[model samples]
Target: MFSRLWPVMRKEFIHIRRDPRTLVVMFIAPLMQLILLGYAATTDVRDVPLAVFDQDRTSASRDLVEAFVASGQFAVAHYTGSDRELAALIDGGRARAGLIIPPGYAADVQGRRGAQVVFVLDGSDPSIAGSSLSAARLIGQAKSVSIQTERRGATAPLLEVRTRVWYNPDMASAVFMIPGLIGLVLQLQATLLTSSAIVRERERGTIEQLIITPIRSFELILGKILPYALVALLITLEVLILGTFWFGVPIKGDVGLLLAISCLFLLSTLSIGLLISTVANTQQEAFLLTFLTLLPSVFLSGFIYPVAAMPAALQFISGIIPLTYYLIVVRGIVIKGVDASTLLPQIGALALFGAILIVAATARFRKRLD
Candidate 1:
């Protein structure tokens, strides 16, 4: 057993040393991605595009609008005259939030009658909307307190806030992040594993011998896939263990279901790699193609950005990426404690993607053999 794997392992090492792309994918990419995205991609929504409709146009109203901009959470993108125009800005995707100051000639505040300001948020993206809504509330409350202070000889009422959080009450960022990270890692590993397998063989001029061997196409493909699949599984288990033991991410739901569905997700990624290997002639070409696929899959997969926030075109593109369904499934099961029945739609989607890609890869592999 040692002798057999030693040669195979030695050959893989030679390939890795010879190919810079493989080395980057295997080692540099994972750590670099964790650090880069951990810092860059965040839910702390700021610099949100805001449309203001100051009907009264008084100093008071303008001051309120300025307060929003000064918070650094909102940037005034448009000053609209009519409610219709303000609505259009948000509807047309030009702005993420809209503010309306009712016309009272600024007398209401002076008369000590608290006025109401309407905040309209585009509800497409929940994450951005959450931050924007919080900012709006805080600004409104602060303004109310200031107005009261000015009128009542600098005395203000005491206010206390009681917060109750559900579903991850500890607010562990790890609990929210680890499942998605696992999905990302699985996709990267599975795709890179299978993507280079055949291409590397061809690059080393071993395809002729592989073709002449007394092995059917199915056998050859399975033998190639099983080893890489095992490798991907090991990486996933490592991530799970580190996440649970080191990061303290709780498994609130069915771990068995998580593992089962994860395997289904791998099928699509592995098949994508196999298809790339079948088409690509050079190891460099294979590496480039794999990265090309990997980049968009991560971006559009709702891994970092919410899919609802993306344009209609991109949302449609994301529907086809296997990682998208897997993220929903895994995150739902792990954090939300949702059952398999609740996730049937995502499960079916993953199954369909896996079936289609594996069939296509098999057909291509057979054609290459013939």
Candidate 2:
């Protein structure tokens, strides 16, 4: 059985070795993605360019402006004289945030009347907006406290919630982002490359040749898939090693177990690609179908979004996405230091999904070839 599959697998490997594009996709692509996305896919937004429109033009207002700058979250990029200028700065992408300090703002704080600061934010990206807004609120509260100290010589009532974070104590977005990147990068490239595998053959009139052979459908499917599957696994391992040692991400769980589960993850994604190849007569169609499947998988897979936070309908949709379970399992093992026993449910789900995908892809592949 293994002997029969080797020829197909070898053919695929030879294609990779001979094709510069395949070599890049198989090896260089993932590393390049890691380097690029490691920088891009971060939630920690800082030094947000800010434009201040201080209508008050008072010492107190200046103090307020200084507070935001002191927080280091906002960098005062432009000081606008008017609301229109402030709006223009933001609209023109020169500023990510704008602050409006209304005239008489100092009197409200000194007189013990609650003063409000108007914050204008670019609502285009929620992450940037949310972080900047929260920082702004903190600055306002701090200023309010300072005013109270000067007026009454006492601090405001504070209910400090003592929070201790475990596992990822630093709360680095890289730590969170990188592990999820493992899944995102792997599922996408692995699926995409294989999605075009058979379709490329069809485009080149090779599938007709394949049909003339005595090889079983499963043998053909395994031949086409196993090479890519192994390649995907190696890529995953390479990323894991690079991410671990180079980036200092500790893999607290068993590396062997992680790899084992990752194989299942690859099996599913690769099969999805293989299934796409079956119906797609051209490489472009195969690529489109793969991306059509990939985009939703990324969104619903809980890589960037919390599954619990999604609406009931979207969350329900995420249930069948294999990456959802894989992410949970991988994150649990790598970050939380959970073992295989703790992740049986996810393991089972991934296995089930992989099995189903393999069977479906195989059936379609055989049908198409026949």
Candidate 3:
């Protein structure tokens, strides 16, 4: 088996070495994506542009504006004299949120009637809008509490809620996103490389050579996969190093366990690609098919969006995606540092996916060869 497999594997390595573009896609592209996406794909909304219309012109109103700025959640991008100007700022996208302090805000607070301030948020992007709204509420509540305490001559608050964040204390989005990015990049490259593998052989008329050889179908499949699997593993290692040292995302679990699970993930992805190669007569078709699978995997696999939030139908689709299970495992190992026992269910799912996909891909490839 090794004797027959060695040639195919060696030939693949030779092809990869000769193709500079493949080398770049395998190594350089992932790192570039990791760096670019790591910074770009963040959920922490800080310094949101704020437009303020202070009608009161009092110390209380000025203090409210200062509070928003000092909290680091908002920056006063425009100070407007009228409601029209504030509305214009929001319409022009210069401000994500608007604060309007009514004329009697100070008097209302002083009279113990409770001041009312209007906070207008741009509802175009719900994520940004929601975050800005939450922050605004918190700032407003804190400011109101301070004013109340001062008026009552109280040194301590009547109620204080202490909160602690676990796993990701700072709540850095990169810490949450990098592990998932690792899985995404790995699946992308592995599937693309293998999806084109058999198609490339057919396009170059090399499939005939493969067909005529005494190489059994299983041996051929193993040979086609092993080399790309190694390449995928190397890419995984490179991105892991970059994600950890460059992005400062710590690996809390056993690195060996992570790599082991990564291998299982590669098995599923490679087989899916091989299956694509068998179905697609041309490289373009294979590429298209790979993306068709990838798009749903990305959006529905709880990568950027929570799977639980997806509708039942979409959630069902996510369940079949190997990336979904792999992501749970990757995030578990990388971020939460859960033990093997804790990850047994995800591990078992990956193992099952790899088994089913590889077997199906082998059958399809063998049928095509015959």
Candidate 4:
């Protein structure tokens, strides 16, 4: 049995080793992807440019303006004299946020009447805007507490909720996103790229020559995937190593278990790609189909959004998406220091999905070739 498999494996190794382009892509491509996706996916928004339109330059108004600046969320990029100036500051991309304190604002605070601060936010980039808004709310609440304390001559409420975030203490989006990117790059590049390569061979009429020979269908699939798998796996490793070293992220999990889970994910994704190739008549179809699957996976996989937050129907639908499980496993292992035993359900699910994909792909592939 081992001897029979060796010939097929050797044939794959040769095809991969012979192509220098494949070698470069297999190693370098993943590293490049890591840098691009990791940096872009970060949620820590800072240095938000802000324009202040203070009609009343009173001490209280200045104090309110100071509160916004002190939160480290926004920098006072411009101080505008009128609404038109503030509008231009936002329209010209000079500021992401604008604050307008109405005249008589200081009088309202002094008279114990609640004052409303008009905040104009650039809602185009929701992630950055969200962080800025949260910070602004905190600053406003702090100012309100100070005013109430001074006016009432009484201490503020003693009750406060203590919230602690484990694993991802800062709730850094990169912490969760980098690992998912590993799965995405591997799945998209290895599966779709290799799938297209196989389809290309068939479209060019070269597959008939191989089919007539002694090469088995499984061998052909292996030949198509082995090189791509190596590339995807190498990229996954690059993301893990580089992300840990450069980003100060700790891989606080069992290394062996992480590797095992990663192998399962790569195998599953590659197989799904192969399945697409078997069904597709052209490389174009394969690529489109792969992306069509990839987009929904990215959105619904709980990579950016919490699964619990989604509706029950969508959550049920999410169970079928491999990235959902892959992200959970990766985040669990990388951030939470989880082990294989603790993640048996996810491991089992990945294995089942991989098996089904490979078997289905192999069956359909043989039919297509025949």
Q: Which model scores highest in TM-score? A: 1
Tens-digit lDDT track for model 2 on 148-216? 767875444221111223456555566666677888888888888887878888878888887888887
Residue pairs clashing in model 4 are none
Residue-level error in angstroms, candidate 3, position 101: 38
lDDT of 1 by residue, 1-370 (tens): 9988899999988977887755555675576466445543456666789998889899988988888899998999999999889866664446778888888837777765557778887644456666777788888778778777777853443221122233455455667678888899888778877878788888887888888888888888888888887788787778888988998876777888988898898889889999988867677768767876777677778777766556566668888889988987777766656678767778999999999999999888872442
The residue-level lDDT of candidate 1 at 38 comes to 52
Q: How far is candidate 1 from the true structure (C-alpha RMSD, Å)?
A: 10.1
Q: List the residue pairs that clash in candidate 2.
A: none
- Model 3, 102-135: lDDT tens digits are 8887887777767778888764334455677778
Arranged by TM-score, best first: 1, 3, 2, 4
For residues 1-370, could you state the per-residue lDDT of candidate 4 as single tens digits?
Answer: 9999999999999977876544554465456445434433455656679899898789989988887778877889999999888866664445767888888888877766666777777543345556776787677778888778778853542111122223554656677667767777777787787778888988999988878888787887888788888787788889899889887677888766777788898888888888777667667667766766676576667676545345556668779988888876887677667667667778889999989888887888882354
- The order by descending lDDT is 3, 1, 2, 4
- Name the candidate, 2 or 4, with the larger lDDT value: 2
Candidate 1 has what TM-score? 0.61
lDDT of all the models against the reference? Answer: 0.76, 0.73, 0.77, 0.72
What's the lDDT of the predicted structure labeled candidate 3?
Answer: 0.77
TM-score of each: 0.61, 0.58, 0.60, 0.58
The RMSD (Cα, Å) of candidate 4 is 16.2
Q: Which ten residues in a row have the lowest lDDT in candidate 2?
A: 157-166
Top-lDDT candidate index: 3
